[model samples]
Target: MTESSPTVWGVGTTRTLRAHWALAEAGVAYETKPIQSRSGETQTDGYAALNPKQKIPFLEHGDVKISESYAIVDYVFEVFGGDRVYRPATSAERAASNEWCSTILMELDAHTLYVMRRHGDLKDLYGAAPAAIDAAKEYFTKLADAMVMKLPAGPTCLLSEKISVADILLMSCLDWAVLYQVPVPEAYGDYRKRMSERPAYQQAFDFNFEVLGVTHKDLPR
Candidate 1:
């Protein structure tokens, strides 16, 4: 750790994956506080102040404490995000970036989390719902098809050029999906392979698995 390193309080399996990868991309120094909230420590009084939702991925930049994955990423981009090239250099590019990021959350992550929170190994951490699990898997199949068509490629999409927060968000969700054993539609196989090939993606994936203590059977709760 150094004076420039940002201090981040991250819980297991949280969106901190995105923040961690972003820091790595920006070549920024940072420390992980590891809230260790596996037993609900985040609900405790002290930790609650850092996040209204008592969530993981709370970041402390000097005196400026922040919460939420997107907000934290936006802040990082605004301050230490360097030249706009990493995300979008112009208004239209940024808008496109936002579109891709939204697609990851609204379509990809939502459905995947449902499966994890319902079936898979998440029951050990947050209980289970079979219906939710089924629906989640079902939903993701559609998303996979849509992604296969859009596929975040070409000069306009995030993966087409340089990796961006959009790629980080999508890749993080896909990594979780693999751990959960949710069927990855055949269409997404190529996309997954592309993301896996990136060095930054690999770094984040290894760190996430190591920190979460996961094997093939484990899914983040």
Candidate 2:
């Protein structure tokens, strides 16, 4: 729990939110070197030494320096070895959680981010023709519907009923989704609201924006 032990370098509104959420939930003390997208900090040789990929959300624990969001999550789970609330116990439940997290990151998050990039900086960012906004919107619509259908069946729902890593990952993605003005259906909208109401989610939201000094207001209306 010492400040010098586990240091994290992460970016604003990135999957580093996942690491922050897990740290907060686990009650672990960590020092965060938050990077900005436009600041060029991520590309510096100093940072590149820690993370060859030159990406934010890289973690350094003494001799260990790790990159990748999921890898950091796993490391947090192991090092803290507490907060079973964020991590499911049973193998079946853990498997399901992993599946949902992977599905969201691998499929839904990319699709949503593509739509965001296309809408926000398509020509300048990639210098290529982008997909139609309407088509992207429709794609998000289908993704939302499918995600909503995956909501838990029993008393323990993904957002409202229990605190799971899936909830954290989903909350992180939704943070960007909201800022990017990604069109989520009513069901997913409600789900996002439910997650946002939680204390952990609130902390993550405040920390991400505060450290980054960016305004969601800049997002498209």
Candidate 3:
């Protein structure tokens, strides 16, 4: 990799997909260093030195290292997007993008979808909790209802006419929800279908599967 090339340190997961989608949308030339959690690659001392938290999808740009998917996506947009379609233009647009992304990450992805995964598909790794799973399902249903209300009248984008980080973030999370069998609101079905057709999203999906040695069918759909 060149000195100017950014590197992403994970693959397969939606969190990593967020980084890839943002970079692709911004037309950033980047490299991937696939670290498989299933193989314990993230637990090693080498990876730990890069991120003490030992999380997947950490980003390295020059000497700067950033962990967490949302932060990485925002950093990519600010540093590389500029006037690109991935970065919002006006203050209202920026706020809308932030609101959508934050809501998806916190209210849906982290609290609900992930909780469902922990208890459902990833029970072996995280230990299953029936009550937690049930509660998460209930909470996720409510959140999905809210998402349905916020969804723009779109064949174009989420916050605006142009695609932004909010769309990327929401699409990634919704894909996760689909894979994990979490209930997605019917209103979002069309939005998901539309965003899934994006070239950037397709490229990111291909890269993710190629690096992780998994196919679409291999995921929990």
Model 2: per-residue Cα lDDT at residue 92: 81
Regions of candidate 1 where Cα sits further than 4 Å from its true position = 83-85, 118-127, 152-159, 214-221
lDDT of 2 at 13: 60
Residue-by-residue lDDT tens digits, candidate 1, 1-221: 87767987774573777777677666677888776545577888888877788877888887888887877776776677676326576888778778778877877776566455646566876676777777787787667667666665443424446666777777677776766676776756666666566565456545655755753234322
Which 10-residue window of candidate 1 scores lowest in summed lDDT?
212-221
Candidates ranked by TM-score: 3, 2, 1
Q: Return the TM-score for each candidate structure.
A: 0.80, 0.81, 0.89
Q: 53, model 3: CA deviation in Å?
A: 0.7
Task: Judge candidate 1 at residue 156 and give its lDDT.
Answer: 41
Task: Report model 3's TM-score to 2 decimal places.
Answer: 0.89
Residues 153-181, candidate 3: write the lDDT tens digits: 75768876667777777888778777767
Query: lDDT score, residue 93, model 3?
Result: 71
